[model samples]
Target: MKFQDLNTAEERIQLMEKLSETFLSRAGKNDEEGLFPFENIKELKESGYTSLTVPKRYGGKEISLSEFLCLQEKIAEGDGSTALSIGWHMGIIKSLGEKNNWEESVFKDLCEEVKKGALMNNCATEPQTGSPTRGGKPVTSARKEEGFWIINGRKSFTTMAPVLDYFNVSAVIEDSGEIGNFLIPRNSQGLEIDETWDSIAMRGTGSHDLFLKNVRVKEEALVELFQPGKKGAAGWLLHIPACYLGIAQAAQTYAINFAKDYSPNSISGAIIDLPNVQQKIGEMELELMRTRHFLYSVAKKWDEANDETRSMMQPELGAVKLAVTNAALTVVDLAMRVAGARSLSAKNPLQRYYRDVRAGLHNPPMDDMTIQALAKSAIK
Candidate 1:
């Protein structure tokens, strides 16, 4: 279905389900070859999936937070890597529109490109400082040169690096000593992508190293400035949990089907009839249902909230990431138990799901940090 044809959330979700069929079939091959899902990305762009989050003012769909999360999970079920790789762009685009953090004309122009299938993502994490969420300044620095800013630094784990049309790179301004995000076009001189990603999970994400050796851009490229240690509720980040939940769901589905089909001579019926197997299945379902409830409820709240109400939800937002991710890990573990040793087979997807779901533990809002935040919130 075309983007213009999607007048409602249901239509957009149906389109994602249709695209997921192809992604599901190609997922294992992409992981085996350690190759990027270029075709999957191409299909997303062609089908106008990339434009779904753009603001309606920019001639895009302007989907709500709940709708975005729901569609994102569907995509993840097909391939975790593809879902995650695209989620950054989806979330950032939506956040930028809602926050209006960039120059109006510049952002509007970029939104126009997004309508035409362009993609972008923030490059904040560095090898030295780790995630920008941890509150360390970027080693990447930008210097003012005449009428332009010259950026020089290497950014690691740049998801969607292969297809990104524009990069919002965070760097410390050389003169002012302020951190700012600079928008660099993909074709900028001295900008290169080094194929350095070799993670065991999310292999198809093409999360390579981004190198900038004196990359230059117009001064207007400074999109947003950072206020150190300051943060607010970010509904868009719900995409991370959405992606992992999809992986867990995939693992659960596989285990259920396997249990129903693997009939043994020791038992007259399928393993699903066994109480132990049924127990695991029931546990997986309970965790998944709980995660969906927490995730969708928070997303729906964000959609209905005003700016002030939304800003106060940072604690809840972090909690959702923390709760949903941990729940997803448990769900995947239960799924593996149901499938037995076969789940560990190299060809089996359960092992892949296990590894991928664990990555969420390392994602932003780490468990320790989330616990601390909750503690501080309680004290206040």
Candidate 2:
């Protein structure tokens, strides 16, 4: 379906369903070959999926947070890697536009580029600093030259690196030690993508390392300064949990179908007729429902909340990620159990789901931090 046909949420969903047919088919192959899903991303870009969250004033759809999460979950249901890869672009665009995080002229230019299928993501993690959320100054140093800032550092886990049009890199100013995110265009001098992504899960995401060896950009590229001790409620991160939940849903469906179809001479009927198998299915459904309710409710609440109300929701947001991700892991485990040892096969979708869902545990809003924040919130 053409993007012009997508005038409402339902139309957008229909388009996603159509695209998922191809994503679901290519998912296993991409995982096996450890290849990036370039075609899948192309489909998203051409279908205008990448621009869904760009502000409407920029001639884009500008879907709400809840709608964005819903679409993300839908894409993830087909391929976790594809969903996770693009989620960064969609979420960041919405968040940046809403917050006006960049200079007006630069942001307007970015929005226009997004409307024309441009994609971007934050490249914050470093070999030394790990997740930027852990509060370490970037070893990536930006030195002011005659009229530009020259950056030098290696950022790890630069998701969608193969297709990203922009890389918003975090670095400390060499002169004053002020930390900031520098917007580096993909074609900038001294910028390179090292094919270092070899993770066991989400292998198709192309989250390779980005090496900036004296990459220079105009000073206007330093979009936002980092305020170390302050943080706002980032509802856009709901995309992370939403992806895992989608993988869990896929696992659940696979197990159910396997139970219904797989039968042996030892049994009178399909395995699904067995009480043990039925129990697993029941548990998976319950967990999935709980996960969806927790995620969707929080996303809707974020949509309706003002800045003050949303700021206080940080704990709840962290809790949602903690709860939903853990629950997704459980659901996938149960699905694998229902599928038996065959699920461990290298080609099995369940195996892929198992590995992909586990990545969530390590994603930002780490479980330890979430628990600590919850504890602090409760005590106060």
- For residues 251-297, could you state the per-residue lDDT of candidate 2 as single tens digits? 99999999999998999989999999999999999999988999999
- Give the local distance difference test score of model 1: 0.90
Candidate 1: stretches off by over 4 Å: none
Query: What is the per-residue lDDT of model 1 for residues 253-292, given as tens digits with 9 covering 90 to 100?
Result: 9999999999989999899999999999999999999989
- Looking at model 2, residue 38 earns an lDDT score of 94
Q: How many pairs of residues in model 2 come into backbone collision? A: 0
Please give the range of 10 consecutive residues that has the lowest summed lDDT in model 2: 224-233
* Clash list (residue pairs), candidate 1: none
In model 2, the runs with Cα more than 4 Å from the true position are none
